[model samples]
Target: MNVGSTSTGTDALAVLTRVSAGYGRNVPVVSGVDWALRRGEAWGVIGANGSGKTTLIRTLMGLLKPSEGECRVHRNIRFGYVKQRDGLHDLFPFTVREMVDMGRMRGRRLPSDRDDRMGQALETTGLVGIADMPVRELSGGQKQRVLIARALVSRPDVLVLDEPTNDMDVAGEQAILGLITRIRAETGCAVLMVSHLLHAVLQISEQLLIVHEGTVHTHARDEAVHKDLLSSRYGIPVTIRPGSGGGLSVEAIPGGGGGV
Candidate 1:
């Protein structure tokens, strides 16, 4: 486990030990990493742009090899990854049901229960009515739900979401975030999300992976998430105050680092 990590006594799904990940030996973006994805745990990864968040995720998912140290995923653990932005859209043109079916159709023979899995996922995501609709015409929030449904259909042990609500309006973002909570409650799968939406992430995640410079520190949410820590990572003056639904609101100061 990384420094400041809390032990919930749950089994670890994947573990990273002193990892340094990047393109090549000379281009390490993040270093000295120690983290774990534990069963039934949810972690929110946050940092400024280009500050090694993607590098870390890629390393963990085995898409990019780490230049140093080791990343181990326990045998039989499956990952369902949702990216910041997907390539599928109106121009590509696939029906919503077809899009989601791709989750279980990844070069494998169709199982007897495939339709049942698909129907359950679509219903869970509230896409039963739009199952036959063209994915190209869905709203931003609907598209996100489709992606999430696709991931869920595979029944992953770990669900990884990258900026799940990046470009939506406030209402849409909140709706998608709320949907995630509902899914977690129903499925009990572990979740790890990296998002720019700071306040919402802070409110939902039980643990925080604070990536800065070239390293990561894991902290229990209530123990270390504060304006000072976020300001240091973002290099700006920040103020955090109470917000609606008992969540904290983050504001960037216009001038410089001055207290509110």
Candidate 2:
């Protein structure tokens, strides 16, 4: 695949050039990938299980070093990440306000505008109504929103979500997806989502990183939603068409032995 030159997309927030990143065994999960996260862009990273999706994101986050090429991020660009699983102790009863406050930068003295930022984050996330609610009592969708609010309080330039809808039921999944779309539109923060929600991803993302057979292909939305590319890859019939909000809609054709 043509991973592109390092010098391209100089205005992007981050760029990965010919990057090969993985762990142990002298083997890389992904290699020779060129990815650029540009300003005000929403990106979707998708692939089958263990197809090196996480490796790519970690490489970009500086959690892993590229064994081959270079990964670069713009200076002073803050990243807010919502991992698929949070490490917080569930036994501890934390309020919504307290939980979001945890995202504030720790220093000798807190930022003078901390309260204002917290309020804005809560408002942006629709958490103002439940700002004092106990986190343990929240529904799945509400919990996800709290996580997003926590991240937003930091005013990050890049927001990364690792499978934001992985375990949700249909309602919860759609809620989170809608919230994500709204957040991107309102905040204009660059969103990088690592998700299994393929259709939802296609609906909201402007750029796509499709990892297939150890190769990462960068695609525009139009190129990424090809029926042949998806149907053949997933071993099922798939449907594709234009969606509301100027994006694409995809569906799996039913009655096949294996699902899409």
Candidate 3:
């Protein structure tokens, strides 16, 4: 892999140059990646289970260190991260407002603008009425929204979501996806999201990244390259076609199962 240089983009919010990440000093789970996330852009990452998608995001978030190369964020840039809701402690006694308020920790003090941002985040996620409700009382979908609201409280320049809609049903998935769109539209926040919802990813992303065997394949959303790359990476006869709603859809070819 090329594992491009460390030269930053003119307006990039973050840049990854020849970056590699893993649990310890062992063989890296993801390596040789070169990417840049520009302001107001949305990038979607997809890969099969164990392909290191979460590792890559965590590395970007500074939650994990890269074993080699650089993962650089714009100086002083704020990042908001929303992980899968499954990781939330349902038994936590915090109310919705208190939970979202945690996002303010990144700042020195609760400035007026930051306070307004937190209130707006809760209102934007439709959690205002339930602001005092215990997080344990919320449904799965509601909890996911609360998580998103918490992330938004920082008014971060870059937002990263790892499998935000993992366990939701179709309606829940659509709602979350729609909420993501609204967030980007309103805040113009650069978004890096890892999702299993192929069609929704296709609809929202400006760029698509497919991770396979710890490597990365990137393509513009409108590019045709993904069809072959995805099929080869997944070891399946994957097909990409237009859906009735003018979005792309991916499916495995029937009876064409065993891959090349």
The model with the greatest lDDT is 3
Q: Candidate 1: deviation at residue 117, Å?
A: 0.8
Point out the worst 10-residue segment of candidate 2 by lDDT.
1-10
Residue 151 shift from truth in candidate 1, angstroms: 0.2
List the candidates' TM-scores in order.
0.89, 0.84, 0.89
Please, what is the whole-model Cα lDDT of each candidate in the order they appear?
Answer: 0.80, 0.78, 0.81
Q: State the lDDT of candidate 1 residue by residue for 1-260, as single tens digits.
A: 22112333348878888998887557689998988788878899887777788788888888878778878777667678887655556687788899899888653465568989999999998999999999989888899999999988888888898889888877877888888888888989888889766777776689988788887988888865577877887677787777545667667786775532
- Per-residue lDDT for 239 in model 3? 83
Compute the lDDT of residue 198 as modeled in candidate 1: 70
- Residue 58 Cα positional deviation in candidate 3, in Å, after optimal superposition: 1.0
Query: For residues 135-190, what per-residue lDDT tens digits would candidate 3 score against the true structure?
Result: 98998888889989988988888888888877777777778888999999999998
**Which regions in candidate 1 have their CA more than 4 angstroms from the true location?**
1-10, 106-111, 243-246, 257-260
Candidate 2 per-residue lDDT, tens place, 1-260, comes to 22232443467888887899889766889999877788789999877677788888888888888888888777657688887645444688899999999888743456679999999989988899999989988877788888888888888888998888777776777778788888888878999998655776876687788776567888787787888886665556777766544445556787754543
TM-score of 1: 0.89
